[model samples]
Target: MSAPISDISGEHKVYLRFLGKARHFLFNLRSFNLTPAEPIPAAATKAVEVSVALGCAVNGTAQPSDIAAAVKMASQADVALVFVGVDQAIGAEGHDRSHIGLPGVQSDLIKAVLAANPRTVLVISSNAPVAINWEQENVPAIVGGIFAGQEQGHAIADVLFGDYNPAGKITTTWYASVDDLPHFHDYDVRKGRTYMYYQGKPLYPFGHGLSYTTFEYANLEVTASALKPQKAVGIALSITNTGRIAGDEIVQFYVHVNGSKVQRPIKQLVDFARVHLEPGETKTVSFALGHDDQALKYWDEAQQDFVQEPGKIDILVGASSADIRLKGAVNLMV
Candidate 1:
């Protein structure tokens, strides 16, 4: 017998061991004085092995339309996890897009699959937001995976297996259509552009995400009755998960100035926190707001840096921009 080896990495060792077995079988066949049939090609052999390992029957290569058929098959399976999102088309390097709908019948595929499988879970993978056409009530769960790095696949598998609870929230709005966005292209110009400048409605407002569990926020408190220029203020709230499963909650804080020399968006996200909680667990989450968040950066003829002006600032706390659970007001005395 050949010398046994244990120093190889797991994946490397698996292939090495397969090669060893194949060689042994071929050697034994030679001793029978009979030639063996043509051996299978390594690439083809690997493909078959991988398919078997994944418990997936090779249904041929997946085309854009095949996604729908796959979903139909998944609907019949025990569980369905659909990974849907825009890839390089709208992510990275691209500053703007001509249209904002699902590309190449992807949405149509999702709709067909979701119709057939109401219990499916949608894991949205995108660098930016997307408009999902399917009925929201039909999907059992939805998770946003925002360019989640190298370990994305592992992280997703872990979440689906209940090994990791999703705790992330939306950083930007998911608008119903491109038209809803303010100036679609120029919103971020020198003077105007941002969620605060936008006029129309978004499909899903910023800082919005659903967890496996539920969380309730209460007891809103602020460190200072009034904010002053060049000073920091603390805002705290208690969050308790009322659901059965353990999960993470993202608490968002928005600021709205009653009146200002310069115009402002309807609301702006100033601070946020992601807190983990077990069932019936409660924790205090807090964040500090400084001159940067409260003040508008304007060119000053005398003073160089951006300055804060006296104004009424509204502090709204909630799960999302559209869902403010609590509200507190403070006047900044410049």
Candidate 2:
């Protein structure tokens, strides 16, 4: 065993199970001295093993006329759930794409489907960014299903129904169009590469996720009025579920320090917490920060060290970057 079975084995009681063992007759294949005339090639054996591990039972595609047929069926229903996006043919390694939209006739299919059924809910499967300004403006709902392997269908269905409350936050900034992105040939990052430097309006900002229920934030406080370079700072706030159902509210804490010695981001995320509360239930959340998070650090080439600046650090807290509901500040002294 590479790391010993003790390091990885689990001991779970299966409904008060009993332990039993059976001894089998030992057979040595060498004693028979039997061999195949032609042994299977190593590549064929590897391919079979790999295919067995990955399996062939994932979501499959429809035929040429299947999309229109699906749209016709969806037109009669109250809600149309449309699953569209790229597959390994266009999104996998060595498969560089020419555009940032849906692959093949998918864009045309989307328009046709929407014309037939306006209440279409689009589930997009992609590893990279794609333009969805039209869908964002017209569609009732859209879910990003980023290459979630085989069981992504279950997750999509659960979110569509009320079985699971969607609370996942996006990590990357998505542009409204491929034109909004800088050319791949341009190495300059100031053209808006990510959430930290992007100045253009995005369809969905970073740290954005829709939930079934709503939340209210109030009672924001800080543990200290002033902070020292070597010391830590703490923040506290309360979140209440205002809607009629129980859901999770991800409370994020961001810090902005002006008068810094170096160029800084507009706001930096320092900490966050996910609190699940029932209707009218309020929960208090707290976060503590170390030196790096409490102050703006700059490289001191003269001393060959990173130095923290003493200044006022503005603390912003809320459900997301755009929805900050609380604000406070603390002075950092040497």
Candidate 3:
């Protein structure tokens, strides 16, 4: 057995439950039949803490021997799963981290593992976005788990083994580096914050995720080209599963105010729909953009109320904010 299993029954209740509801499975890391030439240190094994709540206290540089042993194990294994993350010390309430890089020698660990095994999957568990540009360029697959609960082990295992196809997309724009961001004290979102106003090329754009299957987007139609500020419109599109396997696709609808008097988001997500499709199956996704929707209106500081600007509004639909597949325009009449 790779790990010991604990039975939870009436009288056999275990109290050392720091990681709540976490069940150790039998077919774990050891079950993969990895044989390292040298023994890996406890510090090396502690680097892969799947839970962000478990504070990563392992500090300073990684020992050469530990790294060498890990490399040996990775080279022998078919695939290596490198888990790295930040903890409460690095990311928590009221504590602002100066940079977004991985804490300690976690980056070193990832780079070493990737060098040893090209077929390495980088798994990150953190409270916020991390700049893993090197890994993004080299690592074949990356799984971001933002404090995924106690059952994250089973969930991650399922995805790794092809038992599950991940369709959930990241809600935040992952910057390429900390240098791309404005000062944390700059509360004004327009000063390069969030996906709405971020100007730099994101490492991973908002609503970015990959599935086992591929999807094709087409047939974008808007109900009205011109409408009054108070009127609503229906936006519809067809999405087809073009791959062999079944999966879920999130159709995102975005809008931008062209030539507005005041500042506006480059492109703002207005509506989204998640649909499951079998192989070769096609589905129609529709979004009702009404007058009251926040995306249709911008905060008018002078007027002290959210107001719809009278001008051309560009409509974009696709997988993500950066990967817009369909484009259409509308006019908001004065």
- Could you tell which candidate, 2 or 3, scores higher by TM-score? 3
TM agreement with the true structure for every prediction: 0.73, 0.74, 0.82
lDDT of 1 by residue, 183-215 (tens): 654545323234565555567777777777888
lDDT of 2: 0.69
> How do these models rank on lDDT, best leading?
3, 2, 1
Please give the clash total of every predicted structure, in order: 2, 0, 0
Q: lDDT tens string, model 3, 1-334?
A: 1233443223222222233322322112222222323445666645332222221233324667766777777877778888776656566667667788887777888888888889989888666788888888889999877666656777888888788888988999988888888876778999888889998899999999889999999999999988665688899999999999999999999999899877889999998999999999999999877766687688877889988767788889989888999998878776
lDDT of 3 at 42: 62
Q: Which stretches of candidate 2 lie over 4 Å from their true place?
A: 1-64, 92-95, 185-191, 299-305
- Better-scoring candidate (lDDT), 1 or 3: 3
For model 2, what is the alpha-carbon lDDT of residue 59?
Answer: 26
On TM-score, the candidate that comes out on top is: 3
How many backbone clashes are present in model 1?
2
lDDT of 2 by residue, 105-185 (tens): 665566667888788778876656677777778877888887554456568868887788878777777778777778977
Taking every candidate in turn, the Cα RMSD to the unseen true structure, in Å, is 11.3, 14.1, 8.5
